[model samples]
Target: SIFASGTNLDVVELWFPRLSDEDQMLAVARFNQITSVQGSAMAVALPGIVETLGTLHARSYRLGVATNDSTSGAEKTLVTLGVAQLFDAAYGYDAVANPKPAPDTIQAFCDLTGLKPTQVAMIGDNRHDLEMARAGGCGLAVGVLSGTGTRESLAGIADVILDSVVDLPDFLSARVKETI
Candidate 1:
């Protein structure tokens, strides 16, 4: 994913190591311009995302989003999808010391919500999300196949894997039952 490159430092240091610092800044600025402008148009809520998130919200789940997107871009996209109100908080790359594959965002989620890592279930569609969850010591790290990641890619990282976000409610219900 384009966002995997993260900030200017990430882009220069990881993606284009040979780029001059000045060039890296220019690249980052251009990338941000394109992404921010196209962000809303690119916001495609997958099938069942709204319904599933709505159901969870109705059940009083405290939902949040931690993404590599810019905060304004994430908010705009979520609002465009008509699901922004469902989330209690939304953190993006700039909000934390580090982005995904590090624990900063997840830790920010915990801090913002007054919840412990053990009380959180991190559900994502990619390896970075799962890795972030793991790094944060979340209780559950779940992977969904609806996005870029394959089961093979998420194997051994996610505690449980689901076909899509729509399955989450049932999966949570089953987990509750198991505990009882």
Candidate 2:
């Protein structure tokens, strides 16, 4: 069963028994193939995501990825997508004792980037991301209608729901300008 909790931030918890080493390897291979295909095919950034990340990176805002995937898997995905350098910090399950829903990975990212939790925003495509961000005390929790996260799935937990990542930069820029 899938378990989840939190509001404006949620934890999506999947209950799966530990995989055997062989199964893990198989899972990784399948994941790699799927991710490689998706990354290679997406020639454009998700509407506003790239611009936001790029703008933030250029402004020296600490950028990080806290994921439940393995380190190698995350690295491969980022590299394949040609966005590895955008992140100032990256944390995966292998990099921490606990993964999403536990908050360890996000906490590790905060530690590595030297950013307070309130200075960070967690953008994700799932309930797990929302939960993790909330648990980690992220300032904002944004859900994208990408991957498997549907509007209903991300409702309530997300402070803002975007159609794609492409909207992020524009949204953030507007917010920052308003604050200034």
Candidate 3:
């Protein structure tokens, strides 16, 4: 939805324009370079992601993804992963004036969900996510080892570093109980 904005879409198009008619046929092949990595693309949901999302959904927790990816790219990845339905809201790079390092994206998510920043937890794999969570005043910033980020890389930024998204359910389960 936000991707319709001219400023943002222009930037995205500049970086990754639509493939030519001929190249369109090679889209999958080209995409495979990044997505086919052992743990690179979001299309291959990490271990424990489904169960974690299921638990969160079952508990009626509001789930959202605030990412620096374009809306179309985000939707494509989610659909490919078969988990598009799990998120209550999805904000893309074009959703706000500022991206990751800025709190705008996360703030937009909070605004859309009618949730305060303090009620949200940001689960990501990068320094930018941690900075955004902090800037947005999120309840917690959880970093996972599924991506390029390492424990040391996330050292001071994250509130907690998890082995993988799979461990998220247990963490949230405990947190929910504690809050109650």
Q: In lDDT terms, which candidate is top?
A: 1
Per-residue alpha-carbon lDDT of model 1 for 15-93, expressed as tens digits?
A: 7778887988887677666665697778888988899999999988889988887666777788989999999888877
Q: TM-scores for all candidates? A: 0.88, 0.73, 0.75
Q: Rank the candidates by TM-score, best first.
A: 1, 3, 2
Q: 49-121 in candidate 2: lDDT tens per residue?
A: 5667778788776777766654655666666667889987667655777777777877787777777888888
Better of 2 and 3 by lDDT: 3
Cα TM-score of candidate 3: 0.75
- Candidate 3 structure lDDT: 0.72
Deviating ranges (above 4 Å) for candidate 3: 1-42
TM-score comparison, 1 vs 3, better candidate: 1
Count residue pairs with overlapping backbones in model 1: 0
Worst 10-residue lDDT window, candidate 3 = 1-10
lDDT sort, best first: 1, 3, 2
In Å, residue 173's CA in model 2 sits off its true spot by 1.2
TM-score of 1: 0.88
lDDT of 1 at 73: 70
